[model samples]
Target: MPRENLPEGFEFVASLPDPDGRVNMTDEIEDFYGKLDIDPVDPANISVGIYQWADPGLAYDAKITIIRLSDEEKADNAISNFKSQYDEMVARGLPIFSNATVNGHPSLQIKDVRGDNSIRYLFLWRAGSLVTLVEGNQDRNQSLELAEAAPL
Candidate 1:
């Protein structure tokens, strides 16, 4: 399925394949995802899309995590939780925090307070019954543009 709303000249991948042309998810990726304090909506099925340039490059990579909640109420709760999580992070001295809109959906954008530019951008928003999270190492403007193009 064509999942995320990626901009022109971009596509989605199931996962980044290793040299063996296989996706090692459960053992490798899941653990790291778990470590991240910000998690996708819980107890809901998820569809993941790794966004990349059609021309391919390390610089043009991002991820979209779509959490399909079972009900509208669940989606609302998830959004609330997500906001609280980010609020807590800000309270803990996380510097960059901005609220914006992406294609009509309310979006929250955050960056590292420590001035580390490793993670260029992170965007979270709730659209209908889906809670979407976007992460990228690309430029902030590019990341926001990708989020704006999201199907949400």
Candidate 2:
């Protein structure tokens, strides 16, 4: 996570507990994949950082998750799994962009519209042995900006 590069008005929030400083997802593989609706991919470790906007008028929060795999191949597989899931959603007529790039890296962007008319964006991409997911209750531009600024 790049605290300094966060968009203006965003403030840091507590990170998900990781007493060991490295959490192995395999321990909770079912719950993890269940939440994301994707097949599980073994990752060496994972970390999460949460952020909120200072402006109360903005209903936006961001969760940046970084997953480190044993090698680049595993990282690629993880990203592919996510893309495949998003592709299924797209087939069902959801507003998802499967062919986007963040910082010149291939990325997937999913636009979710809430009943309250607020939108959330999810961006996923991979760099070397690391896979990064940037999800937020913000617009597409803001999501991509955060993803680009991330220090993956």
Candidate 3:
């Protein structure tokens, strides 16, 4: 469908940039993977529905701001009115879960980020704002990049 064909709430936004442009983050990852003798599919292909620019529709029952939270900030906020994303991960029996830390992008308030043992995919989620990205296998690298790329 044409760009204009999409409904107001359904704007088109590819996870990777268009082929005509050299801006898709996925392309960069592909290039890096090629050199490593790996394929993009090798990584867990985690993804959230809406792209960065597209309209963030009614993802959650109510709209919430995508607070660019840091690891430290998340913890600080956790003291009050914070949800325990890790608790869910633990319940799901995630074997390869990487608990969010304030190591890098210190202002990223990622609600939930973990790997699903059953599907062998990594899931990075931000609830209240409703942004979920799932990467399977080696695709988890994408989540890492996205988290790092966030304006934390």
Question: Which candidate has the highest lDDT of all?
Answer: 2
lDDT of each: 0.61, 0.66, 0.32
lDDT of 1 by residue, 1-152 (tens): 24455565567765433345354433222412422243443422555567775467545556766676666666666656555545666777767678878877678886733344465687877767777777755467777877776668
lDDT by residue (tens digit), candidate 3, 40-136 = 2212222223322233552211111122223433423422223243446567775434455322422333333424432322334444322233322
> In model 1, what is the error at residue 85, expressed in angstroms?
5.3
Residue 14, candidate 2: how far off, in angstroms?
2.2
TM-score-based ranking, best first? Answer: 2, 1, 3
Error of 1 at 34 (Å): 11
TM-score to true structure, per model: 0.60, 0.70, 0.29
What tens digits encode model 2's per-residue C-alpha lDDT throughout 34-116?
Answer: 22333444444666677886465466568788877667776666666556655666788876675678888877776765668
The list of candidate 1 runs beyond 4 A from truth reads 1-11, 15-44, 53-61, 80-89, 112-117
Pairs of colliding residues, candidate 1: none
